[model samples]
Target: MVTIKDIAKELNLSYSTVSLALNASPMVSKTTMRRVKEAAREMGYKPNAMARALVLKRSGIIGIIVPDITNPFFSSVAFGAEQAAHKRGYNLLICNTEWNDELESHHLTLIVEKKIDGLLIASVNKKNHLLEGIIKQDLPLVFISSAYPSARCNFVGIDAEPGGYLVGKHLTDLGHREIAFVGGKFNSFSVQRRYAGFIKALADQKIAFNKEYTLSGEFSIESGYENGIKLLKKFPKVTATMAADDLIAVGMLKAMLERGIRVPQDFSIVGFDDIFIASLPGIELTTVFQEKKLMGELAMNILLDELNSGGDSKREKKSIVLSPRLVIRNTTAPPHSE
Candidate 1:
C-alpha cells in the first residue's frame, strides 16, 4: 500500500504541499496538483480512506439502507447510486434492512459510529426515531423512495399518488368499471399514496369503489399470488386489476394464468414501477414507468450536495419528485365480450 508520503518523498516536495495538492484544494496551483496526481498514480499510491477521514471529517463513504436488494427496482436504484458515487470519487456501503426495524436501527447506528459522510434510506420502518436524531445532528440524509410525510429532508422518488392515478385513469378510459387493487402493507407511505390516488381516480369517474376490492400483502410475487386467489374468488365481476407495483402485478398474472383466465380477454391488469421483469415478452405488464435509476442518482447527488455544502441549519431542504409515464403493453385492454 503506497502512501502519499512516498510520492512526496520521491518528488522532493513538502508533505503539506503534497497533502493540499492531493486534496485538490484551490490553495495549491493547478499545475502542481496535476503533477502530484500523476506522480501519485505512477507510484500506485492509495489514499488511506480512514486516516484521511479522521483529519477531514469525511469517510469517502456513503451509507445506503434498503429493504431488499433482490427487488429489481432497488437493484436499479443501487446501480445508479453506485455510478454516481464513483463519478464523485466516493464509495457506498449498502445495508439491507429486510423491513426489520431493529435491522434498520442497527445499520443506522453503525453508520453513525463509522462517521459516514451521508445516508440514503429506502426505509421500511417509518417509526424509527433514530432517524430523527440523525437528521437533527445535521447528517446528510436523503430518502431514496418514499419518505415520512412530515420530515423536512431531501427525497428522491416518483410522485406515488400521480403514478397510481395514471394506472387508474388508463384502466377507466379503457372502459374498466369493476376494478380490484392489490398492494403492499397499508401502513406504508408509498402504499397509502398509491391507494389514495387510485380511489380518487375511480371516484372522479363515478365508478363504484368497493372497499372489499382493496387488499394488502407484502410487496412480493407470492403475496400477489395469495391476494389474487382471494380477489378472483370474492370479486368475480372485477373487470380489471390495478397493482401497486410490477412485482405484485407479475404475481397476480401467474395466479390468473394458472386459473386459466385469459389476460386482457377475461381480465385486464395494470401495475406501477415499470421494472425490468415487467417488460418480459410473456409479461409485458402495463405499468407506470418510474425513473428508478434516475431516482438513485438524484438521491446520491442530493446527499453529496448536502455533505459538501456543510448542511448548514439555514439551507432549505428539497424533495425531487420525478414524473411517471404509463407504458401501455400487452397486459391491459378494454373489457372482454360478454
Candidate 2:
C-alpha cells in the first residue's frame, strides 16, 4: 500500500524528485537515487504494474489461448511460452477454449480489452475471420501449432503433412494395407494436411483409400475411443490405424485392449505428437514427434520480436515450420496373418 507520496513525506523530498529517483532517472543525483531506493525497500514499496504499463505503453503481459489445456500437447506449448516470456520479464495469461470457436472468439475479445503486449493462439478452426481482423489491426500475434496461409501473419507450427506422410509410410512398410485413419475434425488444416500426406503414401504403395474407414471427431480421448470402437467393429479387416494425435491414439489403444485385442499382434496403432502419456511403460505408442514445447517457444519468440520492434512500419512477418520425426515404439509392428 506504500505509495511514492508516503516516501516523499517521510524523506521530506519533492514528489517529482522522489519519482525520478525511484525510476533511476538520470536527472536525479546518484546519492538521492540510492537513498530513495533504500527507503522504498524499508517501506515495502511495490511498483504498480498498471501505472508502469501506462507510462511505457505496454502491459508487460502476453496472452495465450489454447483449445484444451487437458491435452498434454497444448499444455506443453503453454509451458514453453510461459518459460520464454518469464525470462524476458513478461507474464502469460492462459485461456482455454475447450475447442469451441465461440469460446475462442470470446477469449480473444477479452484479451484485446486487457491491452496485452502480444498474443499466441492455437486456433480452434482452420480459417478464422476474427484472427484476420486482429492481424489487420497490426497487433503482435502468433499462431501456435496452426496457421492460415492467406493471413500472412506470424505463425509457428509443425510440418504436419510430412509427419502424416511418415506415419503412412511406416504403416505401409510394415505391410499394413488394410488401414484406417481416426482423426480430429476434417475441416482442421492440421488434419487435412496429415490426411493428404497419408493418402499420398498409400497411393505410392498402390493401395486405394477407403472413405468408409476414415473417421472424424474432436481431438479428444473420448472421441478417439468412440470412433475407434466403431472403426474396429465395422471394418474387422483393418490391420493398422493412424491417429491424428497422441490423445486419440491412446484412446483407440485403450478401446482395443479393453476388447481383449493384442496390440502389434492383432492390430497396429500410430499417433502424432509424442506426448508424455505415449511414452509410459505400458503404452509406448509409436508416433511422430512434433516438438510441442519448441513450437510454443518459437511462437512466443516471434511475438517478442514483434513487440520489441517498437511499431516499426517495416516489421517483418515470420513463420517457423518445424520438422516432424517418427519415433518407433511398441505400438507398431508388421501385420500378422490371421
Candidate 3:
C-alpha cells in the first residue's frame, strides 16, 4: 500500500507538494512535478479511489444497466462501453435488470446511492416511473435503447422504425405477398415502432396488412423457435418472415431447418441487429445492422462528458438516432418459381 507520503518522504518533499504534482496543479513547478511523479511511479503508488472520491466529489465510476446480459447484442454493447471507459481511465459498473422493472429500479437506486458519476441505461420498460424520478434528481443519464417519450434525458439508439420498414420492403420486393413478423412484446416502444414501420411499408407496396401474421414473443431464442413453429403451422402459405432481432431470426432459422423447410427456397427471412451469430456459417442472415458498439461508446461518452462538465453546465438533453444499414446475406432471396 504505497502512499503519497512514502513518495514525498523518499523525495524529501512535503505531502502537499506530492499531492499537487499528482493532481497536476498548475501551481507546482514543472521540474518539481516531474521529480514527484517519478518518485510516485518508482514507489508503485496507487491512489485510494474511495478517499479521492470523498475529497473531489467524483466517484470516477459509471453505471450501465441493460435489459438482458445473455443477449449477444447487449453483451456487445457492454464490451464497447467497457472499452471506451477503460481508455478514459474510468470504471464501469454493469447490471442486468432481466427486463424486470423492480430490479431495474433497485439497480438505479443502488448505483445512485453508491454515488456513481453517471448512468447509461437500457431500461426494462420505457414507462418506468423510476427513470423519470432519476431524471428529476438531475442525475446525468443517457438512455441506450429504450427511452421515455417525455423524459428530458439524453438518448442514443437506432432508428428502429426505418429499419423495420426496410425489412418489410425487402421481403415485399422479393415477390412475397404472405409474410409474418416475430419477436418482441407488444408493450415495448421498440416493438410498436417496428410493427408500425412494417405496416407502413406494406401499405406503400399496396399489400394488405394481416393481423394474423404478426406474432408477439419474448426476445429469446426459445421464444422465437416456439412462436416460429406456431406461425408457420398457422400460416402455411407464408413465404417470408421478419424478426425483431437477430436472436429471433436465429431461432426461426433453427425451427425452419428442423422442419426441413429450406430458407430462401421456401421462406426467406430477415432480422434486425446484425449480431455476431447472424453471420455464422450456416446462418448468414440478411439483417439490419445496428451499430451496437458505436451506440454503447456514444452513450458512455455522453455520460462521461456530463460527469466531468460539472452540475452547472447547462444540462444538455441530446437525442441521437443512428441509422441502420441493411446487410445483404445468404438468408434473403426471391421466392422460388415453380
Best by the TM-score measure: 1
Model 3 Cα lDDT, one tens digit per residue, 195-215: 789888999999997888889
Ranking 1 against 3 by lDDT, winner: 1
Compare the candidates by lDDT and give the number of the best one.
2
The TM-score of candidate 3 is 0.85
Judged by lDDT relative to the true structure, which candidate is superior, 1 or 2? 2
Runs with alpha carbons beyond 4 Å of true place in candidate 3? 1-48
TM-score of each: 0.87, 0.85, 0.85
Per-residue lDDT of 1-338 in model 1, one digit per residue for the tens?
88777888988999888887876555678899899999988888877767888777788899888888888888889889989987666898999988778888899899889888888887657777888788788888889778867678788897789888888899999999999989887878887888888888999999889888989988899999998888889999998999988899999999999999989888898988899999999999999898999888999888876666565656778798888799999999899977
> How far does residue 182 in candidate 1 sit from its true spot (Å)?
0.6
Put down candidate 2 lDDT per residue, 1-338, tens digits, no spaces: 99989999999999888876765555778899889989988999887777867766888799998889999999999999999886555789999999888888888788878888888887656565676677777788888777876767788988789899999999999999999999888877888899989999999999998988899987888988998899888999999999999999999999999998899899999999999999999999999998888888889877876776564435778888888999999998999885
For each candidate, what is the lDDT? 0.85, 0.86, 0.83
Model 3 poorest ten-residue lDDT run: 307-316
Error of 3 at 283 (Å): 0.6
